[model samples]
Target: MLLLGMAWTLPNTLLGLLLGVAGLARGARTRWQPGELALVFHRYPWGPGGAMTLGNVILNTGASLEVPCRTYACRAGLGTEPPVLLADHEYAHVLQYLVLGPLFLPLYLLCGGIGVRNRFERAADRYAATGRGWWPWPAPRLP
Candidate 1:
């Protein structure tokens, strides 16, 4: 299943690798996170100081798994503190990529790109703060 997911998101993952490699030339560092099944590139010099997830890759301006903003930090227990769950948020995106494959990009844009209004981002934040609700759409009830 992991392999299938990887293959499903290969296109975006390749693009992520291309960008990540470029960041490496400018002092970025990468680490393979088996748990998340993603390659994280930290200290990426090009962003406006935040993280972006493409398929199974995460590009971070500060440090990997650190929240890019203070929006719900207090609620998440990461208010001006260490151990942020930014990784978990981005992991939600990875799950989306796996399920949607290449369609994730287009659908994400259609859903509002990135911001509070974006269901994807909102869901990701929800998952980070709480251990559930990662799926952007409501879960189906069991019979």
Candidate 2:
């Protein structure tokens, strides 16, 4: 089971790390919460709040972008915090990353064409809407 988990998540782990580095270089900030995953908040000041980094993970720029990552998620909004629904939606993507691993990207791309409700998205949407969804996220991602 541990091996399966790793196999399913390794790609996102590596890719997410790289993007995280890029985001940090781009002036993004990371917040780590105990008993929960950390999130990278972008601060560049562009977009409506959502962007995909490295075509793998979700990045929150400024508005209300809700996308998923591996362990963490970056959401968009304004003020001091992003909306719970947005954060939940992105966090659900994290769960999908854990389950799908490298396959996650291909599946998301192959089916997620223009947000037409592909299988990958449907599963993620379901997870994010669950009672256990929505981990605390940050202000935003890179500009």
Q: lDDT scores for all predictions?
A: 0.80, 0.49
Which consecutive 10 residues in model 2 have the weakest lDDT in total? 70-79
For lDDT, the strongest prediction is 1
The per-prediction CA RMSD against the true structure, in angstroms, equals 3.8, 11.2
| Residues 55-129 of candidate 1: C-alpha lDDT, one tens digit per residue | 999888876674544434444454453333777878888888888889889999999886666788877877776
lDDT of 1 at 23: 96
| Candidate 2 lDDT by residue in tens digits, 26-142 | 677655322123344555243444544322344557434444332212222212322235455555666656556677677668774435245544444445556453222222778
| lDDT score, candidate 2 | 0.49
